[model samples]
Every structure is written in structure tokens, then in C-alpha cells.
Target: MDAELLQRFNPEEFYRHFLADGLRPDGRQLRQSRAAELRKGALGSACGSASLRLGRSSVLAGVRAELATEEALGRVEVSVELPALAGALFREKHRALGLMSFLSNTLTELLNSPAVFDPAQLAVQKEVCWMLNVHILCLNYDGNAFDLCLLAAIAALEDTRLPALMAESGEVPRLAVAAPGSELVAEARQLALLARPLPTTFAQMPGGQWVLDPCAAEESLGASVSLCLVEGRWLVFHQGGGADAGRFLEELMPLARGEMSKLTRLLEN
Candidate 1:
């Protein structure tokens, strides 16, 4: 039987053959993650933007700033969109919506955390402030969407710059769009980030063996556990599939930390 046919017809068995030899079909060892590339400021129209490619999966994140009332100050809104063209699974509206909600909520929580970002930074004054809207779009879906999305979001935020504020007597401060060759352009400030939380995902195979950064085929076979190291703490999110979460963490923390360090260096460059 052809390899692709075998993978499609009996994925579990196909993976078992590879696992027995301590290898994955993608030519990676069990603990190896796919090569990743991150490019910041990918979109000129947005306040800030980034494009990321992890193996075959691709994601883009853009940050836009809008004026907001005191009640909405320091509020960051996140939305994730998975078009049908991204993958077959997204063609099912309900499934796509569910995933989108999960990703959006997760990102919102992380970005809003004081440990990750300071609400005070968004404050322009007492009555009004800046609200950041982060929009994430999945360009391709080979698997591991959570990791890709989070990385892209963080990179975009790091690339963001808050426009200069112009104040008139007795009026609320408003964003100033600097004209070309204007001095106001130099007044823009880079968005300050308190921390960067990088995520590493592992998928449990049929025999309870965990593989890091599973592709689409491997993901369909088992549950996945995603670990984000945030300021010396681990944030764990597990997708259902009967895997042992505790053991997965205990055995994988060292590897996850190393991956996080590499990601940090990537963002710095």
C-alpha cells in the first residue's frame, strides 16, 4: 500500500510504525519541533502586524488601536478567524467557531494578564485611553494552531506603536496621524510588554507516547497538551483525548523551557 493511502486509511497503525523506530513521518524525532519563522511588521496598514510560519502552518496577526472610554481602557480584544480555505475541518462552521472562540478567549486572557502586560500603559488620560484590537487569521492549518496563533499575537504586539496623542484645551485627547516629514511621527511610542509567554504543544500518540509539535495527521490521532511558560510559571491547556496531563508536564517541562528560550531569542532578533 502507498504511504499516503495508509496514513489516510489507518492513521494509528501508520503512526505506530514510525513510533516504533522513535521517529515521526515528518522526519523529526519525537521531541523535535518544526522549524519556525517569524516576521514582524508584515502589514503596513495596521498599527502593528506579524506573520509566522511553523512547518506547514501559517498565521498572521495584526494590532489596531482605537480610542476608548475609561471603562474600556487597557482592554485588549482578540478575535481568531479560520477560513474554509485553511483546512477541511474549518469547512464545518460549528467546529471552526468553537476553535475560534477557544483561541480568542485564551489570547485575551493572556494579554490582559498583568504579568504579561500592564493596563496602565494603555492609559492616555483619566477619561479616555487606547484599546488594542488584535486580529488573528489562520492562513494554513497543518495543526498546532494554538501555538502559532499565540506567537503571532505576541510578535505583533511587540511590533506595535501607539500613535501620538493630540490634546486641545477642554477636549479629550485624540490620536494624531503624523503627516510625512512631521515631527509628531517621532512622538509615537512602542507598546511596552511586561512579559512574553511562549507556548509549546505536544500530542499523545496511540500508545500514549507524546510528540512535540504534531502535524495535522498526528493531531487527528490523539489529544494535545499545550504548555506556555509565562514568567517562570506553566500555563497548561489540554484538548481531550485520554492523555495523562500531569505526567506529560512533568516529563516535558525541561524541553518546553528550552523551546521557550529559543522563541524568546527569535522575537528579540
Candidate 2:
């Protein structure tokens, strides 16, 4: 949906639709999604990857596995970028850089937090280890971009399989990843395992109506929150738009759980 359509939608009408059908204007059954598709190994050179299209919004996530530096070992470096060509509005170079910085900081915090991946498992040789460079490209915008990116990253990482690490010399401690036969498999072996903690997002529209995965129109109507759930708990990251956010959070709990269940099924299949 277009952002302009969202800006023009009447709050009263939107709420009326929700009340009538127990769903949103898009008729997604409150917890239902419009349809999502994921592509793995989309980028030929990347070690691991996936791309997801949630209706009109597109997210491409790539995993670059590398030996961790002393400071970054046992941690994941997740970054996001919306290049100028990716969106018509983001034509300026500075705008794209600024967005990348913002996204990197936000995701870095999540990856480092205890609620997400377990950083301790990344250790290799007691110092040098493995790190995940998760890069997200937002090729299109239609609201719910943050949630889609997070979901895509998790799914891509889940599908990723790192090869076993072997020492080349006892003195030098040189290591080799992946298996001997395939270069592709050998590259994958050098990395450590990745741990993923799931997160699901919900949006609260106007008139106290809550919806899971609100499209562009519903997102712009009022204040909304992105609730990041991990292991049956909530780790809220952002809630914007001068809305009565607390009440909305309480109301959307059940809806978020239901949507997450469906999402898990989609990825598993």
C-alpha cells in the first residue's frame, strides 16, 4: 500500500472495519499475513542468505561469516542499509548512510543483548572466533520494515550451516573451514554456530484497534510499537507516534503470539 493512502485514511472508518470483521482494512484476520516469500542463496557469493517480500515491502539479508577480532569475538555485527537506488525518496547519499548507521546501531544492540543470540558460543581458540555479518537491504518500503528485516535475518541464519573448523598447524594454530571437496562448503566450515532468538512485531492503529503486521496505511495512522518477543518474553525496541502505547501493548499480546506461530510454520515449511 502507498504511504499517501495511509495518510488519507480516516481513523473512524478504519476502526469500524476492524470492529466489523475483527480484522484490519486489508482483511488479514488480525493475526494473518498478506503472504510472504523467502529466497535463499539469493546472492551467489554470500556465505548464507535469504530475501523476503512481505506484500510490497522487500528485505534482503546476507550472512558473511568471518573470523572474529579480539574485541568482536563471540558477537554478531548486524547492519542495515537502504541505498538510494533502493527507494526513490532515499536518493541522497547522506540519507542512505544515515539510515545505515541507524539500522546498524539498532540491530547491534539486539544481537548483543541476552534476549537474542548467545555470544559465548562464538569463541574459537579462546580468543579468535566467529562472527555473523548480517546485512539487510530494504529494497521497498510499505511499513513494517523493521519487523520484516528482523524476521528475514532470523530465518536466513536458521537455514545457514557452518562447517567444522580444523587446525592446520599445532604451532601457528591456522584454521580451515568447510569440507575439503567443495570450496563453498570449506568456506562455511571456518565459522562458528549462530544462535537466534525470535522476535515478532505488532501494530496498534487508531480507535484502540490492534493489528499484527499492519501495512503502510495502518502504520501511518497513529502511534505504533514493535514488540520483539524472545523465548515467550517481550523485548520492546521502539514505539512512536503520540499514542497511548501502553494500553495497545497490553491488547496486542495475544495477537502477536498467534502471528508468530504462523510465521514459524511458514519458515519451517
Candidate 3:
């Protein structure tokens, strides 16, 4: 179907289908997320890698560790893009660029959060720190890209294995970089994962209906609310245009919080 025609389609029928069956069109309960699958160490060259599948959606994450000698203690740059193959309809350059901008801004905030990661650990010398680069690729974006991206990034970092570091006795603050094939002798440190807890997205229909983790079709028809809460320290909540956005977020907070708590355990291993 063409983009215009797809956008013209109404979601009342789909909502009715869910109401009649007490389940979503995709056969999920109101609070249930689609099935999720996680595979770690998928990229051989990266320090850490993982592929994630959430129902029809797919995302991959890779982590690279580089030496940072610059004076800036902490610097993180996140870029997200959708390839033409990922979404046949979104092949335009402008669309891809806009998506990258959005994802980068969202991720940079987490990196800047002081509670998430320690900048001092990256220091190799008196003022040198390691630069950790994390890349998240969206293979297929059925919906809920933010939540999926965050999850994939965390999973990949958890799987990351770093190399050994040794200080050199030569002049200045010198050190030998570890070869990839060398034995694992470096002390591993945790990646800066923002204390941000779980991410739950809600799609609010015209009336009072609120759907969690809406598919692409539902998302096109209604407004969305994305909430990320980290236990007690932080909450990053965003709402997009759709009717009754105020009520939806207020009522959905507790429910979304519960789901996030459950999802956090999946990242543990």
C-alpha cells in the first residue's frame, strides 16, 4: 500500500477486534509485550555484540573500546539509522537523517547522566580515558524503537569483554595497548548504563483506549507515550501527539513501571 493510503486507514476496526476478544490484534494481553529473544556476542570484531528480536522487530548492538587521550573526560555519541531494507517505505534520505537525530539526542542524555557511568575509569594516563563506542542498528522496526534500542545496547555492553592494560616504564605516562588475541588480563569494568529502568510505550486511541507497545499500524493512528524509569533515581517520559495524552500517561505510569521492573531482570545475565 502507498504511504498516503496507509495513513488514511483508521484503527477503529483493530481496536474493536481487541475489545471483542479481550486481546490485541496480535494476540497479546493489554500489558504484555511481544515475545523477545536475545543473542550475545554476535559480532566477532566488536568488544561486545548482541542481536535482539522482539516479535517481528529486530535490533543489533555493537560496542568498541578505544583509547581517549583528549582532555574531555566523558564524551558519548550515539547514532541510530534505518536502512532502506529495514523499512521499504522510509527510503528517503531526509527520513533517515531525522531518525538519526532523534535517536542520538535521546541516547546522549543517558550518557551524560552522572549516575550512569564513571568518566574516571576511562582514564589511561593522568588525563586519558577510554572511549566506549556503542552502536545500535535497527534491522526491522515494527514499532517501539526506543525501548528496543535501549535494551539491545544494554545487552551488548553486558556481553562486552575488554583486553588487558599495562603501564609502561618509559618517559611520560605511557602504556601498551592490548592486542585482541592477547589473554584476558584487564580488569573489567561495567559500562555506563544509566540507572534508567525499563522503557514502556503506550499508544492512546481517540477515545479512552490505551494500548501498550502498539504495532506500526496502531502507532500511525494514535499518539504515543514512552516512559523510562530507573527505580527511584530517574524517570524520562515523553509524549507524542494523540488525544487524551494527559490521562493516558498518568493512568499508565504504574502499569508501565511494573513491566519495566520485570524486564530489568532479563539484562542481568
Best by TM-score: 1
Native-vs-model 1 lDDT? 0.88
Maximum-lDDT candidate: 1
Give the per-residue Cα lDDT of candidate 1 at 76.
Answer: 82
What's the true lDDT of residue 47 in model 2? 70
Error of 2 at 154 (Å): 0.8
Using all chains and alpha carbons, the TM-scores for the candidates as numbered come to 0.93, 0.76, 0.83
Question: Over all chains combined, what TM-score does candidate 1 have?
Answer: 0.93
Q: Name the candidate, 1 or 3, with the larger lDDT value.
A: 1
The TM-score between candidate 3 and the true structure equals 0.83
- Give per-residue CA lDDT, model 2, range 3-120, as digits (tens): 4464356565646656576866565786666688877667766777888898888989988777765654566688887876566646788866775786688777776776666666
RMSD of candidate 1 to the truth, in angstroms, is 2.3
In candidate 2, stretches whose alpha carbon ends up further than 4 angstroms from where it belongs are 1-31, 69-72, 92-102, 163-173, 176-196
Worst 10 residues of 2 by lDDT: 185-194
Tell how far residue 74 is off in model 3, in angstroms: 3.2
How much is 97 displaced in model 3, in angstroms? 2.1
